[model samples]
Target: MSAWHRPSSRRDLFRFAASAAACAALPGLARANQRPEAFTSGEIVENGHRFFGSISRGLAEGLEQANKKWGRPNAYILGQEAGGAFVGGLRYGEGKMFTRNAGQKPVFWQGPSIGLDAGADGDRTMMLVYNLPDVEAIYRRYAGVNGSAYLVGGLGFTALNNEEVVVMPVRAGLGARLGLALSYLKFTPDSTWNPF
Candidate 1:
């Protein structure tokens, strides 16, 4: 009883109250800074069409082709653009990338092509992205092969590959075009006119 002690002074009680308040606030601070977990499949499917619009029959068929040819994708990008070619061609577009973990991020892509390709066209594109470790993995160059383009009912799609990541770009547009060209798309943080 002689050795027993408690917070008997006003200063000691104030110190104890301050320490308890800080400990209670720690969890909320940690939660606020943490990144959210991956998105669910339903959320991805719902938002896919929300950004890209209702899929057309041709586009659906094209997606099936991509799924059968390439594997299922973990993410997708929705964009729109216009371009044409004579001997050399350039295309530029703005879009958003959606993944399982990250909700969405703005993306810009541009590229140059050479071949018999010609004609101006404007189209909305949905790129099915595979093997994406994260959203940042999309900011890089993806190369397209010559003579790999496929068209169906006013819609066209082509597959671009960069290491483990594969992007299947599906487009629905209004134009007349014919040619085969090798191209590489550079995804950047913002839009740029420089095609390199």
Candidate 2:
């Protein structure tokens, strides 16, 4: 056998430990204060939108409407007031870690799992439709009302800023899949364009 390798010195070991701790704290710190005060409508229209594997603004708009039907407490483009619209999108960074596809793996198999996805933007853009009604419908349609929904996780319908809505991410992983199904539900004021 060869001579055992040392970590250079105690100082080096401490440095590694410090670095690991710093890295572990980074994600939680980044997600903190992610909530925004307002977003604009023009930004949604100008920016490219994709939905359910389709690149159609109409569908996205429709989804927004559905979210509203269920009482989307906050809705707007990227720069408008954050309330009124049910669906809201925020800037997201690539390499961000989120539980997206964890259930598929055999090792710990937690059902649809979470993962770190890499893409544009230093922070990942989060699009949340604050509507519980639509979410319930989605669960019924996709996985049947009587039976439990697919492995996609639930945000546990909760109240945010006096509004009942579900949080959803735009990424194409499991979170987005469940959100996509939720988008198919109908919305109130049904104008198709800034109905609220």
Candidate 3:
């Protein structure tokens, strides 16, 4: 049998170090990627009030509406946004996607809208996410029509989707707002001024 020997060349030693570092990082990476199991309707409503700092009846109704459409979402985003319009407009926001096992991921989103409702900007968004298979799914563009405000399509329901994943953004300040505009939201890992 051959006995073990020290790595002879610098190249051999470098390769050994690289392999060791990867092996050491494996466990931490696995834990970081773990996903959450589920979300409850009560938690959704409770968090809505807590996140936006109010317990209004309109907010309660809005959350209930989303719950009915997509029961027990697996994820959610809690954050604020800014936008305005006389006719055509643009919107931008940043938030954290909360999944118990996967942890909070900082995500940024921006959308351009035409013929959307004109309103004052306020503490503006929380998204209820459904059928998100994994966190990587969140880093893509989603499309939906926003042609109704509040009760028309269920709580600022900008029902955007990319393949199997569905994202319905609920606005606390508007109570629910939408209009006859086509909007597409592109999510990025980093903050960007470009909303295209």
Q: TM-scores of all models?
A: 0.71, 0.25, 0.75
**Which candidate achieves the best TM-score against the true structure?**
3
Error of 1 at 72 (Å): 1.9
- Which of the predicted structures, 1 or 3, would earn the higher lDDT when compared with the native? 3
Q: Between 1 and 2, whose lDDT is larger? A: 1
**Deviation (Å) of 40 in candidate 3:** 1.7
The positional error of residue 103 in candidate 1, measured at the CA in angstroms, is 1.6
Candidate 3 residues lying further than 4 Å off, grouped into runs, are 1-21, 32-35, 56-60, 147-155, 174-178
Model 1, CA-based lDDT: 0.73
In candidate 1, which residue pairs get closer than 3 Å at backbone N, Cα or C atoms, i.e. clash? 39-100
- Candidate 2 segments whose C-alpha is farther than 4 A from its true place: 1-35, 50-54, 70-126, 129-165, 169-196
lDDT of each: 0.73, 0.28, 0.75
Q: Write the per-residue lDDT of candidate 2 for residues 33-110, one digit (tens) a residue.
A: 243222233333344252222333543564466455553323321110111111322221122111111111111000
Can you give the lDDT of residue 98 in candidate 2? 19
Winning candidate number (lDDT): 3
Q: Arrange candidates by lDDT, highest first: which order?
A: 3, 1, 2
